[model samples]
Target: MSIFNLIVALGAVTHKDSDHERVLIKRIKAGDNKALEELYELYKSLLFGMIISIVKKREEAEDVLQEVFMRIWEKAHTFDENRGNVYSWIVTLTRNKAIDRIRSKGYKTQEKASTSVDEPEFSLEGDKFDPLETTIFSDRAELVKKALEEIPEKQREVIKVAYFGGMTQSEISEHLDIPLGTVKTRTRQGLIKLKNILEDHISRNG
Candidate 1:
């Protein structure tokens, strides 16, 4: 083939690729898996590169890359045509998800490392469980911790005295030197707040 003809053929190939990609995006948004596969072929390497940059491990980045695509596929109808093109959108999602996974896992690791090795020095249930039970209990414990953290400090202290220490409200008032009405109000509000937090947790977990 003549060099000039070869150059023209290459340009035609490039234009065909770009045109096919545009059609693939439109069809993928319409829930066509074939089009999604074409879109995946066009953009997978780009997506993987962005993920690997953030997550820094080939396996983890690859897993996150798949997650990003699954989200895109599941949510394609939600994508707005006015919001730039599909390639750019997929790249952004891939980077964001990979970074989020990396940060989340890193934070958990750091928290476990920083926590004391000692036990709580008291028996709630001895902290032993099968894997499934431990997962459920851990989730509940986290929810409880988050709920307690939302309470105002003084009310939380008052609650600790009444519940954990087995003191009556009147005893709590006497011990804390607060008015009985104030103690009761704090307890009431604290429990209401705790209930709200627990309801939110159930909704999320369920």
Candidate 2:
């Protein structure tokens, strides 16, 4: 086909993607075998791009891509749109699975790691979060920093001296030429205020 005809054909398929994806997801959730074909058609390129980007070897990428789609097929029921958009979920899963594979096998041949069990790092994922879960961590960190900035200059300085500078309240009092009791009170209040602001911010977000 000519370039124009190819573009027209792609446009037609592009327009159908949203509906196609929704249907595929529903069918996959319902345990339809053919839905796997839809998934391959939908995300093979994206998963391959992610695998190639990370593994950086054609054969390795292909191997990782297979693992990724297999997990996607098995975990179709875990695809929650409320957590994130479809693209983000797939990309996160693909990238993470590839990285986990590489780290396990030292990025050697594709056969070195074949879905092992009992990883120490797996349990650490309780506090561990991906960029896919929520951008809230970084956003709240910035906001807390800015909110700390909103506090009185002296309070901010004292809190920084105590928290970031690893100084005790008495040390802050000596350094800032303030009474020890005053330093302690300021430190306590600064923490309380920051905690309140953080809680309020989290509530607003959720």
Candidate 3:
């Protein structure tokens, strides 16, 4: 299905009955491949959107989605409904897996060396700001924007350059004419603050 259709499918599943989800999980734990397929049909789009939001590459997201389902299949028996609903569990699983991919040594090495010699500087070109334009998943883009608004201005700016702009710390420092240490500090502090804010938001809304 197209990405747009996938997002709509995700929205449809979001409000589905929790008991039905729980039953599906139970069946999955019992080695029912058909139940697994049913679960995948319901959650694949939602999880795919989430993976894309973090990785920003369709191919990588697709690979990660397969890995995520594989993990779900292997670990289904470990899920505890008493602690949280199935949907939240799946979301946490997907986010953690995506973040793991982002932080992987191979990914870091690739990201650091990926910059082309003739690459142009990342710029806004004075265009109007739009959160949806920042990410494939509009809901995640909004959450990120809201979290950014709660951070200090300097930290927020550095993070945007480092992450959304796909610039390394040194590149960000040189581009902004700031000290490398300062750039690193802001990136670190900004991420910690953003994580706390997002965690709180999720807790309140979960």
Candidate 4:
């Protein structure tokens, strides 16, 4: 799916998967491949989007995604639903695997080679502001996008650059010609405002 459609899909998925997820995991533990397929269908977008953010390449993210499910299949018996839900467990596993991939010698070497060439800077308003890449919950992306519009322009700009633009605070400082401290301050303030705005939006809508 296009990123736009993906964001819509993420938002449309209500937080009602707990019971269904538990059943899927139970079946998976019992060696049901169909259950595993059902689980994959449910979470692939969120997982793959997160992997892309970390690994920075669609192909590598796809490979990492397959590896993640394989591990899940092998480790299904170890899952403890009482401690946490399946979504949390799978997301944690995917993140760790993606982090490991980036930390590997081969991946490091490849990343260096990939970044050796200069690349053009992208505008946040242009094509790169994918909501899925941000730290916000994927399942609330559309709401978060609307809530973002309600924040002060300055705060919203910094938050968007930090998250969607994939830039560090220092990078944002240099790019925006602002102090590093200012960048940090804006990001923190922006996130706090965003949380409040998002919560209010959710409450009102529900």
Candidate 5:
């Protein structure tokens, strides 16, 4: 079956038999590799799409998808149904792992450098800055600063280093001596929080 078909089938099965999911997890925890495979087969595409959304790279997303399943295999015993459903747990884990991979020093540095190299040539002398553009930029910067102030201090710090300092995610990780994965998570979460704050601010003020 196609991946989409598989996802739909799995969704139907999970929705129809939540108990079946719990049983699968229980079996997986009890050292059933087959159960783990079953879980992977069910969720791989959904998880892969999520990873691709965060990482924006197919190859890296694929790598992260593999790592996510590996994590699921090793950490299945830690899954607690009391806290959340299995689908939620797996999706969260997949997203977190993909964010971690993209936030790595190596991946960030390579991506940033490649992006910089791919831009078309532009001369400052040939293209003079417009006053309107400057004012708009300034306004946006102020709004962003205000939004940043609302998030936690650590997230604000990472966001500033990333967006203002023009540093790659990996660079931020190295400069702070923080783990690459931690940097990635912070960056992703911080940006999401910032976006929400900005949207709310705009809605109220606009």
Candidate 6:
């Protein structure tokens, strides 16, 4: 699957492992390190892929991935199922951390010193993805493609820049010449529409 497709597919299959992940997070909240490991195993590929897409460096991506889980282990208590599902929460968390890493001075200096600006850091053209992650994204991309196309173009633009382009809201605002609040509004609205579409798809598929 294309990185674009997989990034968009991040939370599109909310029903697949919802219950089991929720149980894992609950256990994690209650001080179960093993549950955290289980959660890490369950999501590492998908999350790491997303992080590498943002940071564009394998080593930095790996460090950010570790920091991401540490944050999860520390803040698992803050996960609110009433607001969103576990998948979306963790995806957002991973994306935010990745963005933060790229914005750091250390990352900027390292990036400036690197001579591989022309080379791709991560590629899905080979056996880079775990077979199961590939399958999950492939199955959901078909389901999400049409629904994603149905949203307003403006909302879709911001969503694409935020997710696939790995740009934060402030950066997106600057890039698109829109106010930061407008960018946030469009992103939230687009995601709400997408979430509703996925939930409807889940019900019908069942």
Error of 6 at 102 (Å): 0.9
In model 4, the Cα lDDT at residue 94 comes to 80
Candidate 4's residue-wise lDDT over 45-164, tens digit each? 667777676677767778999999999999999999766556657766886788788768998798777755322222222445353434235447556677778888988888766543
- Residue 198 in model 5: lDDT: 63
Model 2 poorest 10 in a row by lDDT? 129-138
Error of 3 at 68 (Å): 0.5
lDDT of 2 by residue, 135-183 (tens): 1123443465666776778777787554323355677788899999988
How do the residues 1-206 of candidate 5 rate in per-residue lDDT, one tens digit apiece? 22122222333333443677889899999999899888887766556555554565667767898999889889998998886667657755775686577668998798877753222221122543221111112344356556667888988778656532335778889988999898888877877887777668667775
For model 2, what is the alpha-carbon lDDT of residue 156? 72
State candidate 4's TM-score: 0.65
Model 2 TM-score is: 0.44
Sort every candidate by TM-score, greatest first: 4, 6, 3, 5, 2, 1
- Candidate 1 clash figure, as a count: 0
lDDT of each prediction vs. the true structure? 0.58, 0.58, 0.68, 0.70, 0.63, 0.73
lDDT of 1 by residue, 1-206 (tens): 22112222322322333567667667878889888777777666545544554444556657887888788788787777565555445645664676477558673485467644322122224543221121112445445556767989987777655532335678878989999999988888877776676667667766
- TM-score for every candidate vs. truth? 0.42, 0.44, 0.56, 0.65, 0.50, 0.64
Error of 6 at 18 (Å): 3.4
Please write out the lDDT profile of model 6 over residues 74-101, one tens digit for every residue. 9999999887777767877887898789
Which scores higher on lDDT, 3 or 5?
3
Instruction: Tell me which of candidates 4 and 5 scores higher on lDDT.
Output: 4
Q: Better model by lDDT, 3 or 4?
A: 4
Provide the lowest-lDDT 10-residue window in model 1. 128-137
